[model samples]
Target: MNAPDIIDFGERLLVPHVIKGETQISAEVEHFSRATQETVMTPKLDLDALVWRRHEVGPAFDTPLAEIIDFLDAVSEALDYDKNSYLQEAMEQNARIGTLGARILENCYRDIATFFTREAATAEAVGSFGSLEALDGWHRQSIRGAETDIRAFPPRMVHILAGNAPVVPPITIVRAALSKGLHLLKMPSNDMFTATALLRTMADVGPDHPVTRSFSAAYWRGGDEAVEGHIFRSQYYDKLAVWGGDAAVRHAMKYAAPGFEIISFDPKVSIGLIGKEAHESEESLANVAERAAADVLAFNQDACACARFQFVEGDDEQIDAFCSALQSEMGKNTRYGDGPNGPVPPQEAVEELDMLDMLAPLYHVYGKPNGGGMVIRSSEPVGFNPSGKIINVVQVNELSEALPHVTVATQTVGVYPQSRMGGLRDALSSSGVQRIVRLGNHIGGAFGGLPHDGGWPLHRMMHWVSAEV
Candidate 1:
């Protein structure tokens, strides 16, 4: 059957001008206010046509960096929650995450401004390439009496977006533009609207502009060989920037070769560390519990950097008191306005906790099993992944005991008592943790200066070409 021509672009649903692939198929994708079934006609894979479009549009994005910043400023204003139809549509289609609060949407919008700053971009360019001159044009530098002119060239990139956070699409778009790449984005099934909406906004900035023309966004079943096989070829795309779980990362890795590179933002877990000061006074304990709650419930704990397990150095009574306070804090709305995702925990998660409660003497349960914020106190880390607002509070004699659990997969560690960070930061970094932040701060918010997965992405995304004189 021929698929329907009309496609949902989050806010503005319309018919696509170009289609690829021969097979016509329908997919059940989430839509604003309802679940809708839709059809897609696959246009035949044309590597030459795609490459032509990339070269045609690449020059448009090769403008001055200030122009790009101005374009992004317009996008940021367009994304304002009160006025943005696409964002409104996003809030509706992604009800599972959007319903958490208005502040969540606001925060997503706020993150856009952080990326386009001149200071931030310059710092990233310098940090990654060792000089900003490479960004403007080729720069001459001497090494061991040899002179080389280095220029940062934009590569042809494909971005596989993750839907866990709404801010991802805009961030990806900014990176692609900054690197001046011929970019294609594959939106996740859970979030079909965001990338399209942002791209539409970009087109609105300058219709037929190179930055707009150089971009393409589409969706396909992840492992479909008919589509992936053609696009994943080294001759087609220079880099694959992926953000997903282990399976998705592994799938992309299989396609990596000499000329084709895969930069992956893989699945990671976060935890919180509490020092003995948390038990010294009621005020201190209350502060620690509140901070821990912020880390646990941020983005409904769906963000990889959100803390799922907290290790506390305190007695049973002290730990129990903190848990009681944490339970209360999790249910209450914060300044960011997020609360319990739902009243009930996922059945599988509850079952796992219950079995642990029955089989293990070290496990202690707090709050209701039906959610409203639940906590499990244990002597060691729980065997299963904690989700649905369930936090594993493992009691430790010293915060150092939790270091063994800190692997390369650990993304963020929230520590209490600012001074304690001096002692633990080195050990935690040595253990493979990426970020260390004070408890209560949102772990996912970017200041535009932090390294993602240990490196500056834009620097890595570009091909550093050098000529010897």
Candidate 2:
């Protein structure tokens, strides 16, 4: 039987294109509000063929950086949410991600331009290799009685994309293009449409463009040896960029061979730190609470960088006031108006927290316990993961007490009263947190040159080639 056609990026819907191999696998992809049945070709372990294709496409992408940036700008404009049918379909298909809403989706689509700006792209290239000249061509440097030439060469890359945010795939695409790497993206089940839509935009930009030919996006169940075993071999891909939960990270780690490397963006949690000054005046208290609410509800608290717990330096009454204000803020629309307003907490999570409220002296529950945004006041961090805008407000005499709870799993620490950040930064950095930002700005809207999870991803993704003479 002929394989069913899946959504290929506006190129063609031919069954032969959909299934590249003789053997085919059929599956149903759940698009939240709807489900679509599709078929994927079982991968043929042709390492030599894949590598040759990458090398063939490499020189074409070695165009001037300015031209590449211009191409990306055009792609970004094509992705604008105003009248893009592809983006609309992607938003609908990705709706099952739950935390995403129309406003958030629009922002994600619009932000693609930010990643590929001339300033950002230039900064990334320079930050990665020390100079754009190094990436454009080999640069010579003299050593003791010797000369060495070095260039930043693009590698054959396999990106195991995370489904947490729609922007992730586009960011990865920009990195791959800037580095001139041949990229094969493995789409997550929860977000199958984003990569396709972005790739389709690239196709629209130029069907025969080297950057277009160098890219391919497809889906297969992760850990399916029939697929991953063949592609994960070091002969085909030089690097595997894995972004997902612990299980996914661990699975990708197994495929890292001697010559090949794995760059893992593992699961992480975030928290907020409010100073005691928040309790000194009504205005201060209100400001801190609003900022805390922004951190907690950023991306509807679904982002790994979004703060889930707030450690406020205050007494009982002060803590109560902050919680009251937080509950109100969580329910109301914010600057990104009318987006997702926190999901309903799962019954198991609510039930577990309810039991804790009864037994634990530190636990004080506020808002609707079942869902619709709940805040728990506690003397220490709660054991369960707080979801659906359920924030744990831990009251402490001093902010230092909260440091013990900041473990290796912590990703970002949003702090209030900018003065306290200087003192707390070193401690938080040592505790395995990656980013520290002002309480209200933890969403990571910066354009580029920022290290994600404590490393420059574009730098790490490329292969640095040096020749000594």
Candidate 3:
């Protein structure tokens, strides 16, 4: 059986567990292969730890980006799927799904549900944090220039899924779907489950949901030209949506098919800019620190948008106090895995934190990351390599200076004072960063479908057709 031209994920199902002794997503007619991380049942292959399974041949690539766009235009008109209410719908659905999955997954979905809730609100406020509606608008505008520049080619989209954060995939999935463009989703092996779940949910909502077809999420072992090569060919996807690290994206760019366009959200290095006011009152310090703690636990600070560093505008004493408050906040992260039966994080993360001890005053609180994570620490700056460790505090004279060293992966950087945001927004995007936020809730935000890469538009994902009647 051929895959649907568009899939809702509700009807199409998971494959049966060939392993025989474990729960799995089951279905028949295998034409695609998926990857999973190194599992007890599956041998490890390089860095890809996904469970690979072949599925039925997907519907023809003949649909093309132009046809995809026509479908979106039709859906946009038919469902009156108010391009603006995506966030509200997402929150409602997230809550519904979270409740539904709670008993089965032991409430593993609670955090995800909350993530959707928080991000939805953030997206609505900012125009890009949480909904498909918000993203479609922005993607449309981004493609406008490309539409004018070139006229009959489809977009080659490369989306790099970020494992640091969760549920981020759906935001991209929806945007690409509505843009009516073909999608090349690079699934982060670690967080593939959520996107898979959300896809299932979209199907539950309806098969004709734009998400049903027009997009294909897969794990091609990063640079496996066999998969990416054939798919990213010049005649293939027109835009690329990257959601991983700098190295991941740089490598992805190599496989970028010729004549195809590449639009990406490369690795984002985010920070927290705490104003001296945060330290003015003891209560404020504690309050802000708790907020920092919440941010830390949100996806355990894995997103490029998550705050890896902070520029506290104050003297060492003030900065130290904020650091202490932050440390206090870190101590409260309990979402880590449960008992021995639960998931465990990498020992390498612990080792990395240990290395930080050589530089700064450091400490570690025991907790599991996968399920049982921890708060690893040091007073000095972390080794700077990406691993586990949520908030890093650095005292700064002005928050703006920290922008240069920032990697292109910088997604969301949270600033404390709302008043100073106008100036900082200019500074944040002044470099290659995407969102400059005053509220520190950076981990779970994607609304209003704003230009995700610092006002970068979505029209870049499309090709134009100009004809006179």
Candidate 4:
């Protein structure tokens, strides 16, 4: 017998319970102290009580595949700038609230909602992405030939929101819903209201939109496995999407069942690359580094895609010059997490930064007197050694060594000479790494609808019925 068209979890699911078994928790709020490699909660969160917070928010189940496509059509239409206003007052609102909020903490949902209104509309910037390019090479692989069967399967996913990067989690929600998945979105305590507000707007776009029945949002602590274990074991969800530190992923993984899969976008690292020739413009390195610094400040060096590491090609002087440039660029945003030009508290972040200081082979030192926000590193190291707060500069005689360190989880690596992009394709083509930007413009940049890391998520939570079409 087929399951009901609509399903609801009647009781308020509090404590550590999982709605559909896939678990996405907020590990972004972790305190990276030297004593503990894992992030300690900065939000003063309540994990134990959230297990039972599940209530009847909306319907969740499979919609006909054709209906799914129609919904996508509606979304496409809404994204149309000519017809829809999109993000007019949104960004200005974002600047206002984000600046006033003083920090992008768990408690800033209202401001985040205002910001999303702006940023989401920034799609208006490039025709609201209607004309935007899809990031993955998967589009080429999505074969539309009649020989290939387009089986619309409803996958299950658990979306863990990242408090550090407010707007990012909603993108995952859109991806899963667009693919016709039954999405169980576990809200990060810090930003629950923000996603809730988004879903509310989505409801406006189309009340009976399939996302209504297919998506559920709530918040719980990252490591609470008692509820997650039961939820994952229920075999209700197929994919798990987590965004945060490695420990958070490990904790969520413990609940993974065999048939049920995991889509973990865990703690990833990103960097920048420059050909030696970039040193010619002198200003070129600094110009690019400043843009890259904006990328780091976008989410306060919290997003996996944040360019925490930099790989540059130059003489000692050139590298030093680049460092100076990055410092000057990064100088603008003194505070972190959507706040105004406030002060960034690095006591916890610096601990990890200091520990990595010994492990990292090279880095330029900044801070002290001038205070937080400085790039550290001379050249790209042979391997990865993360510094939480300080920027680790690795002066590489060659770019080849940095290749091993870049992974699917990496979001963007701004490189120079833009043409060399094709040359490194063979060397850097890995499953987890995403895109390669040219020199600067690393912040607020993208090829829309790209699956971060490797396009390897198909293995998770999919109800595949393979056939030779």
Per-model TM-score, in order, reads 0.87, 0.87, 0.63, 0.66
Taking the tens digit of each residue's C-alpha lDDT, what string does model 4 give over 1-469? 1111111113211111222322233333433222223232322233332322233232323444345434544544443222322122222223232322333433333223332233332332123223322211112223456444333345656777665555565466545554555676676644433454344445546666656546556554556665576565433555577766777678777766776566677677777776787677867666676666766665556666667787777778887887777766665653343322423545765554565456634544655313336667654452434433346677878776678777766667777668777878666766345667675555455423334455534223345543445
Q: How many Å off is the CA of 94 in candidate 4?
A: 12
Q: For candidate 2, write residues 161-198 as lDDT tens digits.
A: 98777868877888788887777888776566677677
* lDDT agreement of model 2 with the native: 0.71
Clash tally for model 3: 91
Q: Show model 3 residue runs off by greater than 4 Å.
A: 1-160, 184-186, 208-211, 218-220, 333-383, 398-409, 444-446, 467-469
Model 4 scores what on Cα lDDT?
0.51
The segments of candidate 1 whose C-alpha lies over 4 angstroms from its true place after superposition are 1-57, 96-107, 110-114, 117-132, 335-338, 341-343, 359-361
Tens digit per residue, CA lDDT, model 3, 236-274: 444566666678778767765556555666665676776
| Local accuracy of candidate 1 as per-residue lDDT tens digits, 54-80 | 334475446765566566666666655
TM-score of 2: 0.87
Q: What's the ranking of the predictions by TM-score, best on top?
A: 2, 1, 4, 3
Q: Lowest lDDT 10-mer window, candidate 3?
A: 14-23
| Span of 10 residues, lowest total lDDT, candidate 1 | 16-25
* Candidate 4 deviation (Cα RMSD): 9.9
TM-score of candidate 1 to 2 decimals: 0.87
